[model samples]
Target chain A: MSLTPSKRAYVPFVSVEHMMGLVHHIGIEQVLTDLASEIEADFRRWPLFDKTPRVASHSDVGVIELMPTSDGETYGFKYVNGHPKNTAEGLQTVTAFGLLAEVDSGYPTLLSEMTLLTALRTAATSAMAAKHLAPKGARTMAMIGNGAQSEFQCLAFKAVCGIDTVRLYDIDTSATTRCAGNLAANGLTVVECRSGQEAMEGAQIITTCTADKQYATILTDNMVGSGVHINAIGGDCPGKTELHRDILLRSSIFVEYPPQTRVEGEIQQLEHDHAVTELWKVIEGQVSGRTDDRQITLFDSVGFAIEDFSALRYIAKAVKGTPFFTELDMIADPDDPRDLFGMFQRAKS
Target chain B: MSLTPSKRAYVPFVSVEHMMGLVHHIGIEQVLTDLASEIEADFRRWPLFDKTPRVASHSDVGVIELMPTSDGETYGFKYVNGHPKNTAEGLQTVTAFGLLAEVDSGYPTLLSEMTLLTALRTAATSAMAAKHLAPKGARTMAMIGNGAQSEFQCLAFKAVCGIDTVRLYDIDTSATTRCAGNLAANGLTVVECRSGQEAMEGAQIITTCTADKQYATILTDNMVGSGVHINAIGGDCPGKTELHRDILLRSSIFVEYPPQTRVEGEIQQLEHDHAVTELWKVIEGQVSGRTDDRQITLFDSVGFAIEDFSALRYIAKAVKGTPFFTELDMIADPDDPRDLFGMFQRAKS
Candidate 1:
């Protein structure tokens, strides 16, 4: 209607720099704590949200996926790609961006770089699940596969689940050193371990987040003890898993969404009919979590659209009155809605 | 590892203003002509594309959809929303944006405003189909339902299909007047007709593109005569159709991706097993188009992803060395690919 775009035509876009600024504005530990609460709140009302398994296009080298969800009022989707070989080319193995729109008008409200947001959400989700499923009074976590996601997981655990120490291990020792260095000022006692077994020593929460496109065991059945929680993050696509099948057999498996988790999570190693609990049910208090001290609980985390929805929702609220986003003239708005051609013609002059 | 992001982290973003600048720079008619050729080229090599029905999330008022496709070398996807009621609230009925990326590294290379692009592509597709199917010596087009897309369609037919006259008609005379006014300087005979019957007089090509989210027959069986090519545009999505079922039964229906058209195009009114020719085959010469002057050829046009892909491909090339796009730091690139956490941590300093 106006010569310049109306307010509705502009979508708030948080770029990589803006996302980094937002993370620092809200401290990383605080963001993790807030994101966990947001995720938990959404999980409690999971039935109201439209959930679908991410649509993925797989290539020989990697896969690109679209994860979408709507809670009736707001709709959200994330465009993410996972290329395991990308790291070798000096590129991120996983890079993502997302959009949030008003469900009523179907107008986008926010577009954001989700690479950093994803790292925070994934860690927050693992921490939130551990909070409900891990052994009581757990103060130490074994973070195996110390790659890009290692420090975030360590900080999230400290903020959300009260873990005071993180024992880190990676096949590449330099990765472990880098992760340890990143967490040095974060107030957590970081232990650089030589092997996965060494990392697990006295740690009640063990997280497996290795980056490989094959069935590789980061954790074996013999290494997992009773009264512990296994936060499995790397076993995310079919043919890519971290824990041995025997370890899964020994633990009670919990997943984000069964239909998707069965295909992409660590539980892919088990039968389709294998008994597993949906984590939302536990978070909603409809099912028991860690009922006894000696029980082995495993949150087979492949991530889900709802968690991203929660992250977007959280960022949308957090960016209000903040210099963390720029307005993008993404939507075309003609003064008369039926006069787009006229608008184009006028633009020529 | 470098402290600043590399060239790979920046994605070129074409905003609405930039898109308009591009269209005017290229000349709307030239852009339409180029788009038609691009779409035709993609159609000729359609088998090389990974095609699938767009994933849509429909609400009571409108729908949000993601259309994704990949040629082994490159990947593209569009995020579009259609809200018919939005116009009443001073919003465009449809708004869109799309992205293109390298299939190898799974990194986004371009992000562009596709609302204007979609309009151009849709018109180009219609004109492209008409060029292959319209009867010989067709110089006049009956452009029914003069709305946002009317002028674009008329110009495209002129540029690509050699139609010199567009007879426009709409239920709202203001729309017809506006459309005719916009095309006055475009060097075509703009006939603002009073009724649908008046618009079709001596017209060899009839395009019905009305925007109502219901089955309203803008063209009935009795109204459409023989030897005319019907470009049905508004019969997109389920519960929407612009032509009568009787008309579909009488015409030789040609569609882009039968799997999708059968559910969303004018052919949706016909039986699922009803015979229809895939348009790609016709373009590739495997199937004949307009065998005789008396034969009715219907291009059951529901926009497809490959057309959008072709549009993105065209813009990706067209925007080269042009000031029509801005680079957005949409992706996170750590110099050391495995040090994303360190990158985030350093941003604090």
Candidate 2:
């Protein structure tokens, strides 16, 4: 027997392989550039969104979180887990998936593997922030703590901010080597460095994305120059930070959302009432980004739900005419909604 | 190019059809009985589980909720939506899907359609509660508001509490006809009634499972007898209830997870600190169920996440050696955990 799923029964699902295929088909650099544009568009209309801090459940090993947001028309949420020790057991430290649904019906429209999309969106957001805060003609980036996200960050900078060189460093030299090898055939020149200080030498932009779960100083106040933009991604959860406190004291800090950043970003080390600039204000031209070339600036990003929402929307639109998604029969739609029992009885026959 | 998903990438997915097939294969009544046993076992070990009020996002039309819970070893969550007006437009008023994950790694193990499973578990849970709370030798159940959930409630009572007769009533006569027609082949004798009062005549157990989203009462205080057990299922959200407050005043109310039931269950109409017994305590033998034939008992159930967790675990275990599930390549697993960039790059070839 064969069954034809009704329109409501099928939801478009982009698996990991199909997500990779879509990324490659769209050209990774082009996709990153497009994502940055999409994110910027949403950020410009930030006040229209319904935002909330992620709902998290933490255990001794790691934390699982659900981040949800809506723009009145569509709803989206990402289910992600962070387990730093998972890599030691041959597992990814983070895995994620997301769904987009219609606000009118509350039915899921698309379900996609978001591990790859997250990497892309995080990079795009960092580059988008740097585009407004970085020094003019910034061409080189110092990528500290080379890990799974390093290459995507490097390429996003090259695509969005015109960065042509990336100097990489990690405590584990093998990670730096892996990152360099992955970027070998990509357009940018990759520089390997023995220390964070060496990697920071003569770079106009600095990115730190280490995976340690505790407070660790990847950059001291002395290592950071005054004229560069800093992208901080690793110090995301409570008690986790990358840059030394002294550096934050000197830089003009900007954050995605203050309530969430106060708990999960580098600002957690500071007082609750400490003044910080909202990133959307700069994007909206309500505040100045970099008044002088010698002034330091930092983007304290703890990934937000809006970015994931934008990425899901981007993928849902990108895969429309492409064969990169499969329709999964996920919803139970009966011919007569009140006859759900009859639907099951007929299915038995 | 062909891609073979590794074990880490594959998450077991049970679609709606597959879930129906699994239910039929296991026999509907037997599945209900097994689900009740599983739920009871979990209730016995209740203190070992982490519980929280469901995270809900409400809109003008409906509400979408994420209900999450975790034992020390496994984590589970259900994504469910409720839109009362959906049935008028030929859509199920409630649709759901759920995920179960490994707590240590925070990776999803199973993804299953929970619409059918939810009906099964909700009925199973109701019957489980009735088994302890209902009067001895209670063989008749008056089912008010015969809609999607009516048949399941009837069958579950038959299998779990030895209920042999069901008297059905609905505001829509067609709904009552549909429900009674569906139950015609089942082992129980079905009686059609024109009004709720007619259905309640000579019934030992009264079940109200209406779907209206208002403060309307289907049963009045004078309509209920002193010795009957009332299974109230439809007053599951704020401003939606089936029983008048006077009936609640005379009964010993049992609830699941007081923190949640206080807001969404029938008890929302009561005071903040209104005394109610936790159903787990009754199952643990700490509290009395039906102390005497003259005492009134009420199972005021607003579904909890632990029940969904148990249902997911049961499905994950039941379809072990069966063809009732499909593997979904949902997680992106790099060969080397830190080389996620390399994995994406290699997938391009």
TM-scores of the candidates are 0.99, 0.98
| Cα lDDT, model 1, residue B190 | 92
- The 10 consecutive residues of candidate 1 chain A with the worst lDDT sum are A1-10
Model 1's lDDT to the true fold? 0.93
Clashing pairs in 1: A1-A334, A1-A335
Off by over 4 Å in 2: A1-3, B1-3
Best by DockQ: 1
For residues A38-73, write the lDDT of model 1, one tens digit per residue. 999999999999988999988999999999999999
lDDT string, candidate 2, A258-342, tens digits: 9999999998989899889999999999999999989899999999999999999999999999999999989998888887788
lDDT tens digits, residue span B304-346, model 2: 9999999999999999999999999999998888988888988
True contacts kept of 1: 0.84
Least well predicted 10-residue stretch by lDDT in candidate 2 chain A: A1-10
Q: What is candidate 1's DockQ?
A: 0.88
Tens-digit per-residue lDDT, B248-280, candidate 1: 888888999999999999888888999999999
TM-score of 2: 0.98
